[model samples]
Target: MTDTATPLISLTWTDHITGRRGHLVVDRLVRGVASGGLRMREGCTLDEVAGLARGMTMKEALHYTPGARYIPLGGAKGGIDCDPRAPEAYGVLVRYLQAMRPYIAHFWTTGEDLGLTQGLVDKAAAEAGLTSSIQAVYPLLDDEEAARRRLADAFAVEVDGIGLGELAGGCGVAEAVLAALDRARRPYQDTRVALQGLGTMGGATARFLTRAGLRVVAVADAKGTVANADGLDVEALLAARDAFGTVDRAALRADDVELPGDAWLSTDAEVLVPAAISYCIDSVNQERITARWVVEAANMPVRPEAEALLTARGITVLPDVVVNSGTNAWWWWTLFGDIGADADEALGHIRRSMRTLIDLMLARAEADGTTPRAAAHALVADRLPEIAARYGWYR
Candidate 1:
């Protein structure tokens, strides 16, 4: 939430084969473990990973319950600077994981992030001589075998042909949207949404929001934007995506008008969800947005200045640390026996948790007379010190 303090560990790795750079930052640790994901994309940097690591810390703390077995771990993140679609991207990822094996075995528990999938990350981790990308957290499990199976079962269960793993975060995002809309006394049936990115997070969000009666009028992928004023066929578009989250043009409906990728930013809609890469929205493009609320589903998708501008315009910017946190939380909830592998149970838990969290955040923002981001920072600022006091900051 706030600026990242001095990290417990920071390392930059160079892939021996491709010389692609990778970075890992352990922003903080709780109870000997840190949790985050590994992402692969062009131009990923140490600073970005550091910021993401800090966000993870806040996210973990935000979910802290008065008494829960899944005590939140500290925050950490791993990044590899390479296109996941490139031929050698797999090799680069495996080597990067190999280089960080010690950390992965000790302090860092990671899965897939942007530009990577859980299946692919698992495969890469196997090749990297690791038990699992999240093996670092095994020491905390009460029954490692049952916990592993719970998470695995959750991943294997698919709703409407999309893995539950992919839907959890989007479900949280949708809940956040619904929460804001309900608070404003707005009807979901009349609301329209424009989303940037058709990747795991964005695509799943479209599915849930559509199911909830919101018209997903526009969606953007690497190719371009597809728009239909009368809601999109989220499932059809989802089926058209490749492993990299690019939708196939052949699947587009005739009436679905194609626009530039940036068009999603300016599309006429009540809500805009940026579920893609970081810093995609700057002060310049922030002007094009008329959406009443900007729900961040991606890590650091909106720049500080852009958020400031959006807030000045009376647009509620729901911070990512609160919005797209379900996927990470889902993992721990299952692993720590807080929830089972059942889809309904998982989603119900996420909805209740996100709605409660959003309500608390919005209330604090109101009480403090500040933007949601600053309020979230303030909340984290209070929780982090208490968590550290009890957990010893790091193992």
Candidate 2:
């Protein structure tokens, strides 16, 4: 196994105008290149950035397919401690990108993560005169229509009638949930799901799960939690939500019962999805969770102690590395120009890829008699030495 103690590089920057601090951490580099996402949150810190970068490394390694001979990219992450809603956000992003331009152009590439978007990444990249690191991974398509679709997918913008990339991440999680249910011979149509954090990822996941025939009984966001035993109207909630996925406090209906933010944990739903902030489910709250299965759409949403507790209680906790890999798969497809011209085809490919990955992870977990998190980490650890040796970095 490889050591996880140190990252390859870590850098910090300050925006003179906004007085904002930013950090870029590359946990590992393969062939001298790494990629991850840029996160902007008021509470984000360098340590969190480093942790996320390490997660990205493991994620990329799991995404590699031997059949395709795909060499996985290394893990790296960028974070800025600032409010994304502030008026100075754009300026801060510009300054941050300018400071990170060299790494962007030469060694590291990043995209949208929590509190950030692909549009912002594009804007800052353009300002820095740097091509997106995504462009480097895949071959350039000669067809103009395909190129347009590719850009639309990457930037989460509508182009030529194609919708945004909001569904990518959730769709992956939905597929993983379905796979897990199928493996257990559980009927998804009758399964009740409680979703915490109805933000972009959670909202999309709710929509996909509902469409796939699951009943989402409860939903929550930053504002509050709402539930209907019969099943919440996901479409109505989506319509009522703001662009940031916050439902107005005054928008609750007569039948909707509002609860404290953490009350979602007490719901008797068979499936629970945590898609909001990190460390949301910890030792203190783990005892309250009633879901038999927890799919992590948000990175590190479950603390180690919480996960261990849940596992001890016979709850199946699917790690974010596998459950929330749809966007990463989308990025892989986009980079290699593997996705077809049609949107449906692209989505189908993503879902299929998710299913395959989930199956592999589950099988590995069963064989090793370990949790999916350990299985995934072990898989990456097994491959790291070979990768490092190839790059002449192994001791």
- Which residue pairs of candidate 1 clash? none
In terms of TM-score, which candidate is strongest? 1
Clashes of each: 0, 1
Q: What's model 2's lDDT at 183?
A: 98
Write out the backbone clash pairs for model 2: 138-335
Candidate 2, residue 61: how far the Cα is off, in Å = 1.1
Which regions in candidate 1 have their CA more than 4 angstroms from the true location? 1-4
- Candidate 2, residues 70-102: lDDT per residue as tens digits? 467788899999988888888898889889887
Cα lDDT over the full model 1? 0.92
Predicted structure 2: lDDT: 0.80
